[model samples]
Target chain A: MRVQFVLQEIWIGLRRNLTMSISLVITVAIAMALFGTGLLINKQVSNSTNYWYDKIEVSIFMCTKTSSNTSCNKADATQEQKNTIKSDLEKLPQVSAVEYESKDAAFARFKDQFSSTPGMVQSTKAGDIPDSFRVRLKNPEEYKSVSSAMLGRPGVDQVVNEQEILKKFFRILNGLQWAALLIAGIQVIAAVLIVGNTIRLSAFNRRRETGIMRLVGSSNMYIQLPFILEGAIAGLVGGILAAFLLVLSKIFLIDRLQGSLQFASQLSWSSVVGIIIFSVCVGVLLCALASFLTLRRYLKI
Target chain B: MIHFDNVTKVYPSQNRPALQHVNVAVEKGEFVFLVGPSGSGKSTFLRLVLKEERPSQGHVHVAGKDLSRLNNWKVPHLRRRIGCVFQDFRLLPNKNVFENVAFALEVIGKPRRFIGKVVPEVIDLVGLEGKAHRMPDELSGGEQQRVAIARAFVNRPMILLADEPTGNIDPATSIGIMKVLDRINRTGTTVVMATHDAAIVDAFRKRVVELEDGRVVRDQSRGVYGQAY
Candidate 1:
């Protein structure tokens, strides 16, 4: 019976302040959407990092006969020098696998990659391709160690790690993630304040009813339950809307963007689901907190 | 039952006490009238009994619980035994008459079945049976006061405190309200009314306690108003 009364009170209270309820819902929805976007971007960064880093390799470009640099004066490496370099690389504890790519083999691989791009294919000459050792390590962090060891070695002109080129990419992504997160934080604070003030106004309007409730021996929880539920219900509706927006963004925007940037096609569906769940939880919890704080003074039930 | 043992209440930012050192007692099922001019501590005395304001210098005992020792959590339990009606009517403007009365029983956790039966009975007792569906704003001042009365009595509390309940109504309506209160008092509910209405005081001639400058100037059975001065 008490539960029924409380539900009735909540229903009536919501109906009484319909405009405030809608405002609360919109505030929560926008905040959750911003926060959800930040989460999705953060997830995307992690996924891309893991995907690219796992395939990252240190490439040791062998000296060529026509190379002008003093480091390549000896010209092409002999079979004995190649065997010695390969054996030395295997001796390192961090060395997981070392594969040799001859100059002809490197040219063939390049041609296959740019086969569809005639402009890129015609731009590269056969002799321009460098014979290299594609070195894979047990951990991506060991790239620096392997690259340093391979540099200035006999018949080696330049040693490059693909991970270095992608470092700047990750840094930019990380900065964007932080920027989105900052915006989310600001929106969340504004949403909380809006929810608090709305509930406060509702409390003020019903001050007489609350006073009577207090006078009639109603417990504090009994009086606060309806208001808190009001905020939470608004928040829940907002969160679901935000989640729908996020899912739509993933399906439409992110999918289209990834289609153009094919390397990121592997972004996980699980991450999107995780973001939606997190956003909903934040929406409900923060609104409940704001409502509780607002009611602290008014009800005193 | 209520007892005030030399209770004194000093309001904040005031040079003098609102309720000077005074004492009084009223047994269960008794109807007492507290009469005084404005700022004579009549409201303060009622507030003291309600525990809304604490007596600064003495003890106030109601229903055997010392008001001074009652903590915040226990205040609600104490209030459950007492019903309060105000001059403002204090009905939720949006609620209909039935909801106003039902709210009293609702706050006390009365079952829906009990509330449905008791609310109508109380509304009938207050002669507001036809006005149950009307909002407070739509009702006349007399009807609104009757709704307030019904809300006060719906819980069947041991004590009912009315602070100028008829202050907003005309003489005829005031008499009607008094008759309803008299009917409730007949049912063994102790009644403490704080009012300055001389005519009502003289007509009922109950135990009247009059205050002057925070001091009790008169206490008499079958008394008339304005006798203290």
Candidate 2:
């Protein structure tokens, strides 16, 4: 109940175990930093998924003069075949939009994509790429409906779902996010153990004081208050350090991710700020809870 | 203000009961000495009154409340009314004598102004008047015990329990410690002390309750410490 006394006790305990407290602070900082990074990665993956899913297209290539498929019959797809294909795709409910790309337009796109490579642009011929229907589905995952229907169709050379390739990239990012989270989880456990050890040592050091306090009619809450505050203060310092680490990670890790993967949108500063707040709170609560549990087991008042 | 009705105490780890079928009572404002051999449950008697240890079989009552039924949360409140002194004089090594005594009142939420007024009075009562600022390590064994007594008595509790209050001090200093306890007892607080000092026990001529192997073997007024068996 005495603020001055409790504060004094906390200061004494922290000072006595200065090395241990410093280690505890560092452990908590690293754990919270990793946790924040994991959360940012989660946000990055989801943001990219949302951004790229909208642009995903399923391409249905039509037969060319040199098409090898038995259904192509060694002849280019006629205007009638193209019209029937376009009309059938439009009729399907899964299809949101269908745009026909002529062989000349496909060639132009290939040249534009490989503009930096002069040799690749010069070697590609217009007719080499067959005409195709770029089908945008209402749901990217619903590419299966269109692909299953168009496969082996007369005049169709191949049906390629763009989502499949994108899925592999997202899967790798998801794995990375999970790895960050897993390491963060382990670090959190380590932080908890350190917090527990720190509190136990503090309690042991102050056992005489606690004993005197107990005999003098101090409640269990009163006896445990200083120890609990010591843990919380250490957590608070660690959380602040972790906030700095999170800022560095946002600038170095997430920013670099956005730079290399330009197709995915960058994680906004507001979301990073939100994750920082959440991770700091988690750090404080985790240390406080660990200290409380450790006292319950070891310090009997 | 304390009563034990056929109390039996058996710790979980030990097969033998520390105190068996013990019945004793001390009236309010009484100074009683619990004299016995080392393992004869003298310490257990003081602990039971303080509610530090519960009786296994029979009921232990202090200030008219049965301790067996009292809630664990209420134990601190009970302890507030019972001052305890140990042989080792358990003082906060980091705090001075004044802060040590004030700690007792501070823990119980006493006001700063009130502690400022009362801590000096209690310190002076235990004859540590101007030595308030001295730390525990600086004080002698007798002065440290007096400081522990000051801390215990700062709240003006209804009962005082001293477990070997002079066990660590010399014969001359032990007399001074006993005098302080006697003065506190004169203030109408019930004092129950457990001791092994037969000379002081015989000199005091107070109510003596002797225990041998956890049973009350003698209970008499103005009694002396009997011969050791």
**Top candidate when judged by lDDT against the true structure:** 2
Per-residue accuracy of model 2 over A123-168 as CA lDDT, tens digit each = 8788988999999999888889899999988889999998888888
State the displacement of the C-alpha of residue A42, model 2, in Å, after optimal TM-score superposition: 2.6
What TM-score would candidate 1 get against the native? 0.88
Q: Which lDDT values do the candidates have, in the order given?
A: 0.86, 0.92
Model 1's lDDT to the true fold? 0.86
- Candidate 1's C-alpha runs over 4 A off are A40-55, A63-94, A102-129, A138-145, A249-268
Candidate 1 C-alpha error for residue B162, in Å: 0.7
lDDT of 2 by residue, B1-229 (tens): 9999999999899998899999999999999999999999999888888788889999999999999999999999999998989999888887899998998889888999999999999999999979999998998999999999998899999999999999999999999999999999999999999998999999999999999999999999999999552
Candidate 1 scores an fnat of: 0.63
Question: A246 in model 1: Cα distance from truth in Å?
Answer: 3.4
Tens-place lDDT per residue, model 1, A16-124, is 8889888878878888987888777777778888888788888888888766669778577676777878899989899899999988899999898778788998988
Model 2 scores a C-alpha lDDT of 0.92
Clashing residue pairs in candidate 2 (N, C-alpha, C atoms within 3 angstroms) = none
TM-score of chain B of 2: 0.98
